[model samples]
Target: MCAKTLRSVHEHRKPASLRGRSFKRPTTGRFDINGDERKFKKKHSKANGIVSPMPNGKPTTSKKVNGMVNGVNGHAVVHMEDEADTSSGRGVATSSKYAAIQEQRANLPIARGETHSTIPAISIHDPSFATIGKEALLNEFREHDVTVLLGETGSGKTTQVPQYLLESGLAGEGMIAVTQPRRVAATSLAARVAAEQNGRVGSVVGYSVRFDERSSTDTRIKYLTDGMIFRELLSDPLLSKYSVVIVDEAHERSLRTDLLIANLKTIQQKRNDASQGKGKGKEKEKERLKIIIMSATLDAEKFAKFFPGSKIIYVQGRQHPVTIYHSAQGQLDYVDSAMRTFFQIHVDQPPGDVLIFLPGQEDIESLDNSIRLYANQLPPNQQEVLICTMYASQAPGQNAKVFNATPPNTRKCILATNIAETSITIPGVKYVIDTGKCKEKRYLAKNTGGGFDTLMTRDITKSSAMQRAGRAGREGPGFCFRLYTEESFKSMALSAEPEIMRSISALKTLFLIGGLDQSGEITQLGREMAAFPLEPVYSRAVLASKEYGCTNEVLTIIAVLSASSKVFVDSSEQRDAVAEARKKFKHGSGDHLTVLNVVRAYKDVALSENKSGRREWCRKHFLNERALLEANDIREQLQQTCERLGIDWKVSCGDGDEPVIQSFGQGLAMNTAFLQPDGTYKQTMGQSTVKIHPSSTLCDKKAPTIVYDEVVYTNQIYARGVSIISKSFLAGLGALKVRQA
Candidate 1:
């Protein structure tokens, strides 16, 4: 018997809800089972009086007699042919259900004059949707393939535009993909959109980030990190699945965002060529991919010229006017000024939260302690003050409380790094204290060498200052207390330099991966490098590991280096304890191998315990649990990329740590330095003098030559993560260009 026939028989034998219904007759049908015809009785209900022929001339639906019937006991032998073919008829039922749902949705009234009203009521009531520019925003998309959308923080562009596209049937062919620079923003925006549509997350609206994805095939709109979208390009260069690509927060100008925009231009050109019947097989473009670039403070004219035919749409944000305050003179100590300003606002201003922007985590922590001390001094009857600190490396569980509403009769003071400048929204903030500084990673060329040092702290640009000021007005009319004088503000740069302008090595690596030669010609290696999710430095390291036969260990080292947060947590009070705990993973070679040991130990512990126990284990060892988790995730991704590129990477570590260290030297040979007799180090390339960072385990012990991960300058130039290596190893790697003094 066919599968469907068997299913029908099984379904009939099972208890069902239709027990009260009476059968009229048993229809005549073929008995294909066992290839034999089985005679059965027909039954006719007295009410209906319908009749059918049976071998016994008795009713088939009659109650069993003496528990014996047509070759069976206490069971009616029903023919399979009498049942309707449910498998073939199910499509109609499904289609009808969907049609009814769609019809009901179509009947709902459009919110705020939008073409569709599936979004939340608050979104519809946003002033951007009711503004005069709303129509122009829609019309621009209809006319141009690329649109530069400029709006301030409170503008509804980020949340509403995608829905507008969906309502207009512009995204009917495929999903509308929106990219955010940070993961938190993507996931939060997805939740807000899902709430507006009255749908559960991961259905019509979803988000994807590093190691976390909450999207399904039915997702009509997706919010993903810019890095996530770049990874998608490795698999689908054309991004064929998305009909519309929205790059939000374009003003941030991150490395990934810049590369994605450049690659997207290439994608659009390819699609145009394909549509013109120029490519192999003459496969016409199935859909024309539309692009929308949204930014709070965009360089509109520059972007317009970049995309020749693109149009610019400026939407005024809905925000109350904010009053700005500047110091009478330039304040040399911003931390002191910020503290004074905080108390001033708390004591004089109306009840609202205070947001103080600092340069880095160190500043946030120091200021947070000071604020708490001052809060404790206040009278117990006074309104309570809650202090919170926010930085990228902060634990997520604590970060969630940053957005919670303050309790009645209490005020919240959030001391944060530049992360709050654009990546997040902290509600109920009515006062903003801007230090006019932020920690920016800049590549400073060595005075006498070809290489550069990475500087992690720098002054904020004028554009950044404006973004910081705008945060105060997000909720209501507010005040911005600038720690610097107006003259100092004007002296700042127009905008922070783009990542592309600062990192030449990164650009060179990108070209190499794009298959471009010295003269900028594309090569096969360049193409493969573009697909790797790591920076060119790490990607080159993994690619080179294959030659040294230590790809697995090198991959792990790179993942640890790419951790989202600091792996080591050291505070003044627990410095000795933290150091003692970290010593367990020291491999006696350098920080690089130490990192490998940490990863191995973490994995071993993670496997043997539940998640909570694993967290406790990391805590006991003074390791950042989140950082280790992120590193493990990155390691897995890099390994997958290696496999995809057909690199023969062994899954296990080699016999010893020497081979792995040698492989790392092969990739970072140019970063080698020689130890000077004076206890300072000199770079092999420029003979530049540097000191070993205090954090490096090899700082005290000396070796002739060392390979370092980075050279950063704070009070003095310091080589961090120093690993000692033999002179012979350096010579073999061709890194002994500068003779040891």
Candidate 2:
């Protein structure tokens, strides 16, 4: 099977550099050693919404590079060392005290090579680390040159690869950077790596997140959310200090990773030129950083082809043989079949935890209610089962409980959303129930009026199916009971959709960077974004605080809204009451303004009483207390960004924290749409058939409104709504849309 091939590929092939062993010299001696028949990496089609260099010393690029729909140069800017490793000015090794540091890192996981460009040297560490098997290596790893690391959920590859390189004597010149798609992954992985090295979290292995960091002077291995690493590239072009950069979970194709790969390749070429010329600063360490991409199910060959000369290694997942069963007869009936399966598995199945993947919040709730009703059907005390629901929009406390386990003699049933596909790892899970469906956000190609959007519940992709299966067997040999047939899975796409074509891009912040003053290309602002521990959109929002003269306030707002940090309360009455109070200040600008008003109102409450009193204030309005805390975190980060950029950050709630409304409308409306007289919406930029979602506060209202997500996701874009706003805030903020003229 595929697993065997994964092992064979990495085990057999000798690193290409083994042939050039004789010419290997310290640092720089010859371009012959550095230059090869295959030096530049392969390239790929670029995604949309990325920042590019404008023709007039601006952000937009003259020509769109690769297949990128929007304007952007597709490449990651990895730091490069002096070409050929010539006598370097500031090298990590060859220095005195750092040797001890290097020696101590021997136990850490790293790639095998001398500098990033050079493979393992005899004087360095032995080239052979873990014997992958020769024939397998030659046949698989070398054949494609792009490795798809599909290890079962708990494989050591994610934590060990960087350590392997460091120990193998590869990349001795700088730290190893690993990009994780989520914040939890970054924080936990860094902690785990540090623990293995006996150093404090901040020393050998560290992490830098939006409001937190475990990094210090002695750290060499760092786990960073993908965006943070991207931002770091702004200051350290060539990513010179890193020996290797690992792009993890690339199949997810989160916007940051997609943009980063192109940047890294671009920087590697720049490093070679700088070292070859009169460039100064530690530009003498000549080595094109090696990029090791770790994906679950995405096409590794595609990436391998994208980056020429890169090596690909596949790690087969370790999953138990679980019988995949389809919906038995009445399966199409929503509650009936799903609930029936739940009872049968919980009572008749083995003693492991169960994970049932559903579509959206409604599905999770319906299934949960069915299970509870089924629980009552049980004879008293016959079975004490613990049931939990998992969804993106759920309250924080409830979601946490789902990740935790149940008491003894009680079985655990986790009703989950797509978040379980990769985000969180549940400890005791051994069985899985797949709903075979997921709700995804879809962008209408024609809709440009920019008022609202739409979402749909669709079948899960094969990669997602496999990912769900992998979850069951993470701890040991586990089983996954898929609800769909293998035939259905085969028809699914190999990967999820890329971010650019779907999500919003923040070109506003890119304009502020020292070097980049436009949304099209990577400039100083774009580069600074690559360094931050936040998403480009959020990072842009925070960075823009400088322009608007509100750094302190924006920081707090962003931190509170990041990955899994949203804090909307559950009670609709309370939510409505709070919303109503904040609505008094509604310039009718948009949702963002509503949020601002809430924040300002919160500040007023916080000032009147102690922290506990503030919590009470949040409770009375149905607002999440945690969200308030996160807003505070955002503000703090904004404040720090101000300090770093020398921008003045004055924290004040004047105007009740409301934004200009008109400006925000412009940004949100660019991709929105407007409903026509015939009831069919004419989307922004000339698209059609899009409907407003049902979840918007303006859902039942007759006035046209701009929205954030579709009905399947949040219900404000695909069902109904007049296009009173411009596709790009076209209707202008404060222009109230009444019933007709």
Candidate 3:
């Protein structure tokens, strides 16, 4: 009944903010909203990798064959365009602007097939085309239930394997499912694959990411983020609609990817058993599922060990020999080092684009500005430089600029997080500069799920180092300049910890949200919780709202919290003005109610104003209009979910805030804290000290008892999405009914 909630959770897919999962961000000094550069005190943690200061930053398959476990390798990057409000279709029947967008896409540098296009006819130099014959590759997959395919970056495997299954009829009447670790990878790869197929998106090829879906009944092949697949499982546990499921970038081992890998194994067994007549009726002849686990590194032995009888195959990629050079000594500021190296390549080296890998976005922006400043100082004789900054949080339109063809006499310089290390391939990149660092999110697990997420800068792994260097050779022989000494490179780890081992386990979270019973079984409440496309915690809040008679307020608050974008606009130059504007919606109850106030204000304006007027209102308030629109969409979906579940979403408490706060308290029981005598807030469950995030409306304010959405660590452990509540409300939370599955 709550299925609409689950479906709508991912319906508004602007790539989610870079949080929780493993992605890239920045390191070193970050600019505050007031334009002040505060030096980040590096906090070290033993969890993920070695969490250290600025010096750096920075799945599955079975087979029986054996060999020494070597380093993992692979490279695939996405180029998803921002179309939050657009349809999944791409033909005339699609959005009116679809054609214009398609035309613009055709001009992208990589789309020209000058380097590593997956289409065989357009990519003659791609290694997969040269060595791995389509028929032979299909034969391997045909003979094996699981095949661990190890290929290097630019191998064309990520984009080619799905098409092979589709054209060969290996997928039968069912769809071919490909799972990527990131949303951008799924969407961009879908667009590229659709272009290769000569069919409109949502027809023959499409993608499903959080809040964004672009597929139709005619779609024979689909791309989805790992998390999207999990939601699909809640409805189709058997994955009956797909004949083949390919897990790409298996080596990254993000938490979701790992969980997905394990689940796929179980699914394969059940489906194969059914197809063999192990069950009755329709289950007796089910379509057997085929799983292909693809990784960039040659270390397929681990995957082989995981799946009995699975085969391991290595395909050579199109990468050419890359000359590597390391700095004589460590540079304290890799950003400055990167700037000097870019000029070295631009002024003295051969002509080609340059890619500089940083730890995160803060450094990317820092380097972007630095490069432009120096480029302007160069003589007329030197070529002009075009700098593009790429990160998870960047606007889709801006990230797309990295794929544009370089202007005449202009050198393209891309400053990016480790996202450039793999998630995409930019044509004509001949020089690579590695800062030897990246930002990572690690869950510091403690008792009671009071652990916080820390985004710390650490050295890149050895495998990552190889991947970064491989970017230089996408098309031809290239050069890699390492900012650290070779000795430091050897000291790096072979790969990152599997996300499951480092991050909080799904079971713990599910249990805390009342989705599971003590016996580790899914509860009836959990089933209902899964029906909504929200985190278990948020879904629990919705259920709790039923008793509070404040479903309207609860849904509104949660919708904004669930949106992918931030509600407030952050501008350094207008910091003071932004704060002043934010005061209009300030609530003594803290950020959560402040958000409700903002939403209420937006709704009032929406009723009395036109589109332009609404936009003007948002601009004047220093608010993000896109976020509000997305939140409104989420709220509508939640309302529909509530209706289907027989919960009256229209019921509201009007001016009373107590019932609403109580409902949230039930969901946030694991996330609540109380003010200590020392003036610091200590979590009720874990007793860990936390400060309200600076962006929170209640920052530095004393709230006797507070409930927070999450804890994020930068220079300090800070709680975000803060709200005040009564201790008696929390004490009465146990009175809420718990149902079993």
Candidate 4:
């Protein structure tokens, strides 16, 4: 069913009291129902009153009422029928207000060819309709099975192209699937498109991400992450549910995005071959899957060569001209240079917000601190400055504040990483400070085994530098101050290397688990691992846990790892308190066992307290309540995945540290490292030097051998999520050879 049909069914099912009601706009600019206008009356209650300012800058009177009401000169009024009281008596007034607004909208005059809808109508006067090359894009899709769409930053390709396909009836019986590189983009775009279509979300338009989904069977247009679509391929190899697949943000070239494009190409070939040999009826003919590659800075010729005879469509972006400034000399410390440039723009430039792009959280924090110290020296007459931070691990609530409008007589300086480059848009940003560097994950190759390291900070590509500069021009004409010289930018690479060159373990594991023979054919295990929504290493660990007799414990550990990092909150002020509270859950075996203890204790506390109490418990103990809650959700989902793969979900070796450690070690045998005499650790397989991170519980303690979740280079090379393991246990895994120095 379409959204319009669903909405009609819902309208017919409304309560009798709400149906056939007449609404009128009163002379006072307020809603009056059934031709009746009631006088304002004040009522007193036990709760305190709220006072708000009116348009004239005078405070409006407030009074207690049975439910929430619009403040009108201290009046407590109810606009709906008396019998339609809410369970809490507070929601009725809000509902009645919305109902009146809907009725008023329904009675509004429509254009000659416009259709009426209960939902707000989308304006047809959007500038994209006039500027975008709509006819050329539609014609390319109509003629070719594959097409590469190149658009500049504000080109409207992301939103406009999908709607064009929907309106042209290209979706057929399947959905028009659009893949985004980030969850925020997918969800926000889906909501925007749903509004433009005059429909509700999850009906005509929807989105799906890692832990959340708002799509339904009635959905004709779906937006999802690249990773989510990759998982879908394991079940529906032909993508039978989607007629058109759009890969957006292909310029980023993330690991999953590249994998998805490669797989889609293969699927396209097989489907075409099948269609050529079919004695098909008119209704049973298989429709060839149409693929559209959309990017803001995509190399059109390269993609054209990859997909033979593929057409390319270019759309012009609507962006203000941006002034670029390059450094005369390279500075030893980019952080200091960024600080000076930010202050210069604030004092000399016109009133506008500033966005400073740094390498990581540490760099952002350092620059933010320096800005504050310098801000204090400003004259009292100068406007105040508001500083915000943006990073991957930032709390969601705090992240929202970065997008809020700047207050009058003040400016906002958002210190961010590459996350703000293309994933999010911040308004009122007219100036950009580019550090010209970012942390990229790269794989190290040695004679022996090697793992991935993510702390390698390097100069960004010329393409990325341009993307950062484009942020300044999003709102209006602006300026970008690069900390590097023009000569240095010209020496940079054309684009960052693809993810396939950086990490191959997940790909290798996928092939192994798929049960492909020596020739690399898919096996049963590979199909199961693809269905599991986890990294290949973690997926393999879960499957191995069943054989090692600790599936339940390993499931919990993997889910927690997948959900978030260590649950302990890192606050300098509460460091001692957090460590003291965490003592109750320490298992001495390693961080993995400690995580198991934390999850079990959380469950126990949740069973004993109410919702608020559980949240309070986390705060009191300095634990991340969100991470723990997300872990629980993932744990339930992983349990279902295990059951579907025919792995026993209830098997356990009882509550002991040995079995759990052994189970996790089975999959992480190559990650084992042993202590050395020089107070450093070396990986048993790769022979790489490593050290325990200072944040780990076992940081100061000495252990002969340990297993780690990952290696990170910050102040120095360190292994995070460290845990002590028995030498005998390492030897028992069979992949490691126990050798003593």
Each model's Cα RMSD: 26.8, 18.7, 12.2, 18.7
If the candidates were sorted by their lDDT against the true structure, best first, what order would they fall in?
Answer: 3, 4, 1, 2
Each candidate structure's TM-score, on Cα atoms with residue i matched to residue i, is: 0.75, 0.67, 0.75, 0.77
By TM-score, how accurate is candidate 1?
0.75
Alpha-carbon local distance difference test for all models = 0.66, 0.53, 0.71, 0.67
Error of 3 at 180 (Å): 3.0
Which of the numbered candidates is closest to the native, going by highest TM-score? Answer: 4
Query: Clashing residue pairs, candidate 4?
Result: 513-525, 513-526, 514-523, 514-526, 515-523, 516-521, 516-523, 590-723
lDDT string, candidate 4, 1-741, tens digits? 222332332243223343332212124322121121211112122212222122233323222111112112332221111111223221222455555434422221110111111111212111223222345457668778887776655445676677778887765566889999877677777765665555666778888988788888889889899888977886788898887899988877888888888888888888777767765643233456788988653344566667786766555444545666677667446765676677667776689999999888767765676677657657777778899888876555456789787899998999999989866778789999888999887666543344546467789987788789878866455677788876676677867888787666554434433334446776666666556777766776787788877889999988889985447765444658878998888878778988888899899999899999998888787778788888888999999888888889788877777777766665566677888998899887666789999878788788899988888765567888888888987666453242211
Model 1, range 139-212, lDDT digits (tens) per residue? 66876888877664434567778888887876656799999988877777776666545566688888899888
Query: Where does the lowest 10-residue lDDT sum fall in candidate 2?
Result: 77-86
Q: Once superposed on the true structure, which residue ranges of model 4 sit more than 4 Å away at CA?
A: 1-133, 277-286, 394-398, 447-454, 506-531, 564-566, 572-581, 652-654, 734-741
* Candidate 1 C-alpha RMSD relative to the actual structure: 26.8
Off by over 4 Å in 3: 1-132, 187-198, 202-219, 277-286, 319-322, 350-353, 361-413, 419-430, 447-450, 473-478, 505-513, 608-620, 730-741
